[model samples]
Target: MLRFAGFELDQRRIELRAPGGEPIRLRPKSFDMLRLFAANAGRVVSKQELMEAIWPNIHVGEDSLFQCIREIRTALGDEGRQLIKVVSGRGYLFDAEVSGDPASFAASAGLSSASEQEGLAQQAGGHAAATVAGPAKKRQFSFGLRSRVAAVIAVLCAVIGFAVAAPMFAPGVVAPENTPTITVMPFVDGGSDPQATSMATNVTDRLADGLAKIDTIRVVTPRSDVTTASLANAPTRPADTDFVVSGELQRSANSWTLEARMTNAATGEVKWTTSVAVDTENTDLALQQSRLAAGVGHELAVRINAVLYPRAGVASPLTGSTKVVVEQALASINQTTRERFTAAQTMLESALANAPDNLDLQVTLSALQTRGIQMNWYSAAESTAAESAARSRLERALQAKPNYLPGLEAYCRFLTATNNFVESLVACAKVLSLDPWNGSALYQLGLTQIQLGRFDDALANFKQADRFDTPAVSRWTWLLGIGWANLLLGHSEEAVPWLQKSIAITPASGRPYMVLAVALQGSGRTDEAKAALAKAMVLRPGSTALNVAPPKRNASPVFLEAGQRFIRTLVELGLPAG
Candidate 1:
């Protein structure tokens, strides 16, 4: 019997007992997990090691392991994870002290080996007579026809069970087919100034070399310069060129400007273009070249990626001035008022009117519309219209810019809200590929993972969003996301503080209150839970367990049932049935 934290784990019987000697039931996996923890008490167990130990040779989602851990915590009444601590970005540790006497404990629980049993029997002065009779009894036993027939039937059933549930165990998304190819033409010196020539060559070389690092694209540098003459006019298609990148260098006194453009090699249509200006008088020439090349290369890679991966990878065709307008409009997204939302909407609409083909404006407008739908800032009819409009605009934006990070992140959030988990995961992943530290994309990734019952993974992603410190991390939804994941994982103590933080950030919203109610309820603070629910009802009048859907989730049966239970708790606390 291994003892720790007011409970004893009887390894032989595979049971845990409370201090009062009452048995605490645990599922087989939960018991095994507890056993592992007891064995390695005070040691951090990596997720990989835990998974392999508990489920050798079985292909299971990370969520399954998370579920087992949750169950073990519940059985131990370790809601705060004080005894079983989670080490962020690492694994878990059994922090409690555990000790036990092996042989006597095993013998008491009927787990002693034959030799040990014999030794115990001999010590008790009653073993040989019982053992001698046991062998004679075994000799007299025989397998009858009924027993043989039953064994055969059991074997057949096992075979049938294996054949039934194979497809559900399959792997995830397939990778892209082929790598995209891009040709970087030498930069043209558009000025008579002698400094411009060397600067142009350096910029072109640095840009091409930097862009070549993106594994998704094949960056090609031609053996000979593709002249500025061809770039100025419509250039002929180069062999095997999917896209063509060319730029011109201009110098005026101490300042230099590089104007770069990428085009469709076949149609000679401009796909992307940007200009960077730097003062060579203040900065070293090498530093100026490196910084300029890095900027140009980053933009070029985004454009190429969008074309290569059509689902995501579109750059917004907006100048810095135009981008500032969109950023200002996006600021009102989390304010939770129709007036604020509409003001942002009007700003985007005006910008779109001026530049109808601008992908950045379209993307911003679409995202604003989707946010309205999510926040219920629009009337029913208006929401329906907005959803349709947003989808259409986002589609057009994707076509125009293909891998626009903001556009993809917004689409991913929209997809998750609309119950499209698979597509959302893909889109969110694309956003991460372009900018790994994008908090919005990380948040979207967490939301999709939540719907799939991968709360542990979701929580990890949410923490990553915080670490990235993206603007989205400041949004109330970030804290709410972490809170909800903990609530779903049965970590109510942990959930309460996160939900409380969310409420502090955005008290006007109903979601934090609703989730806070559940966390409070789970923690046995019934009166506080009731107050939270009342606040939720006040914020969203006439809202109910039935009408207020749970975050577009279609998870495992256990999670679905747990969701129902949570709702039932809310209803019992006087939430409306409607």
Candidate 2:
């Protein structure tokens, strides 16, 4: 018997009873649903999961499941939707305070008793029926005559039951797992120019995004903690944050240099540090900033992973025959020119050919493919080929070492692109389970949740993504995600600032303009909306402004009210908003 919320369920009897001795009658299916939820309390159960659990072999309609849920909720005195929240279109979640002594429940359920076990199994109904079907059922009676068969079966079952029951008396087992955390400080701007400061912030943001892809580290966001002044003075770490990353920028004639350090917050010990210098005179400031950001982000991710996992051959893996090749590849990646990328690709390929099964080589190849895609150095067909190659390589890497974080993240991205959202979400969840501070995984997962119509989950993920401050590209993407999520959540006003920040960073891009237009239109700023839309058209001709499908409509009254408001704004703006 398990007790919770003033009710107790007897698994053997398959009955629910109140503290005062009244029986709460439930349909056979409703009772099963309640039992599962009670067993796995404090966890979010998706609708797909519930369907699979309760109606495993049947093609049951969602309405049937929902009816059972309604009946169960009514019996529990949960009148409103608040008790068991319907998380948008994804599934229902039960939220209630629960307390039970596991040992007491185990004893009361007679977990060690063969009779109790048999009764519980029989009470499970369909499961018992399924188990007793076909060849297994025949095997029980074929060897004996009718008179002896039942007695023989009884004796054999008794032996088997004792064998199963013996293990229940053993001590329970639980293992301790380390949870790694990291903090990303604001990027240091060596120059006094406002543009430079903004560039630095963007760089830090991107780095944080990249690092968050790793599954063994938690990244802290600078947006809510570190600031411009704090970067210079190295302020104390926040109580909840784990690691702090601080860096310095210095100008040297025509070149700019950046020195960064990652420190453990608890001990104030430097975990890793590196200095990078780039020529800024000939390169545009923005491009230079992006290059620096990518380089810093990649290196920081490597260092953090090493510290957290400490795998063999992770540090200085190419000390023997592949040393020169590895160095060449790394040097090429550090360069900003197209020629350098080609050289890096060649060197990485050679290294992989030499060690075809190497995990590091595979990861480097995937990273190169990502870079090529981002830079547009590869044509559309070429980019597709490159991504396919990367996916194949990452899959091989995972087969070699299943826990490889970089490989897992790369594969997850590929899966997402292929519209395998369920698997991708699971992979990203595993990444989070291993390392909670991974910003890239969080952002990607957030986007996937939004696609799945899990708005609240998407919002939560975006909020978490905002914690890391590394790399300018990641910063831009994170801000863009936040802006879009807010718009979807009907917070048009909150989205404006985020979209504006993105536009400020990438003025030539069409994305921010499109989002800004939506926000403007939503806010009833008709003239501004037209202007913003016009700019977006100019930026990307034949863009899909209103062509995308809207999110799944909810049954909430608030959504209906918002829809009315949206229509009013559309009328004011002189457009067919629907």
Candidate 3:
């Protein structure tokens, strides 16, 4: 008898039963499959091993094995195959605790010993095998002997009952490894209309589809056969799912509103939430639905990825001190003052002194030092020295953790600033491959595109960054990129709104105003253009057409001509001639 999480399997009788003594019938092959999984609980069993064990003498395709797995899950009442998880690109993992009465049952049943099992493995196409087969011999028993065996079985079952039942009353625990698992529940319709319900379902489907694109994430598919009783008595943790996404969709006369939130399944703690509104009056019905679903889906993907992966190629299980140091360093950068920058550098240096091997700290310190040099916080020679040291430390960190998101992002930025456009593009693309929802990587990719004079491609990437905006309006660079891209393409009217939004979010910078001035000048708003130029001059002293270098990313004369025209426009808008 093997007992695991409210279920029992009797090897002698070849039967499985639920906690209520109700027999849970499984097909012959499914029973063998369950036995193998139970015997190796909490360990991932390879597909090849499973196939060999279940179909020892015959050749079979993978579909047969998949069907057996599906049947086993069905019999066990395992929602989302939580007990028999499919490890993507690997095999299946049986994530459960196993314990049982293991004395005379094996000997009485004449089950194969280790040596016999090894022989059976050799028979199974030379693959490493699993033991899911029942005993080959059946012994006839006297009535009195049967009565004695039944008594012994009852006692063993009672003891195993307590063993499995104790965990049901215990605190919920969720154990996730490298990949984060999420479950997206159907969005509930907040409005009375039945059509709203269909729309809500569409949103949920699209959201799941979008999240599935991320390689490091596992999206749980809820069973359609789940009953009302099953949901009412659902496990607190929903098996192995780490996060549950649920929300409401409401529709008004001509607009729809969708709100969603992610909650930690075990703790039931809300991790993140967002609400978006869309107007559908002017758009076609199908197009509106798609746009709404895609928008929310993209937003959710970014938010989830930001929390799970956080940084490119980095799996997040950060230690307390490392998280604190990283947060402080980032906050210091956002302050954008010389004093805060120095303080951040000092804090990182002190932390690194204690734990020089900490890659997170090393990467962050390198980025901060590089940013200080770019901002002209140090003299020319000092800046050069700092850049060299930062680059060396970054190279070391990358050597240790090549896919570390923060390091890759910083390296891309550094490469872009140093005019290594092609290399920057490659590094940023690598980051995106690891985390498609990474807005920072997308922004960097857009900048690389701008440098390469791929204005249309740059626009698309910038818009994607906006769609996946993790911190809402946190990234002003992509907004400015969009505006500048439009201006370069002679769409100054379209550039104004984006440039204004960038300025609103980041007024301390002079770049947006400089571009805004040119945008206004091109639109023949001379007075407004001069006013904008004045603001830019105050923000960035000594601005002049002569000193302002043109972008070096031009592939042909057209881009060069456009750059000259913009510089001429800037000069006409009251910038110094030099």
Tell me which of candidates 1 and 3 scores higher on TM-score. Answer: 3
- Order of quality (TM-score): 3, 1, 2
Can you write out model 1's per-residue Cα lDDT over 179-203, one digit (the tens) per residue? 4567788887886766677677666
Once superposed on the true structure, which residue ranges of model 3 sit more than 4 Å away at CA?
1-183, 218-220, 223-244, 250-325, 332-343, 369-383, 473-475, 550-561
Compared with the true structure, model 3 gives a TM-score of 0.57
Which digits, one per residue and each the tens of the lDDT, describe model 2 over residues 263-294? 76766777788887767776766455545654
lDDT score, candidate 3: 0.63
Highest TM-score scorer: 3
Q: Between prediction 2 and prediction 3, which has the larger lDDT?
A: 3
Per-model TM-score, in order, reads 0.48, 0.42, 0.57
Candidate 1: residue pairs that collide: 306-313, 312-403, 313-402, 313-403, 314-401, 314-402, 314-403, 314-404
Residues 289-346 of candidate 3 have per-residue lDDT tens digits of: 5556555665666566467535544433347776798788987663365677888899
Model 3 CA RMSD to the hidden true structure, in angstroms: 19.6
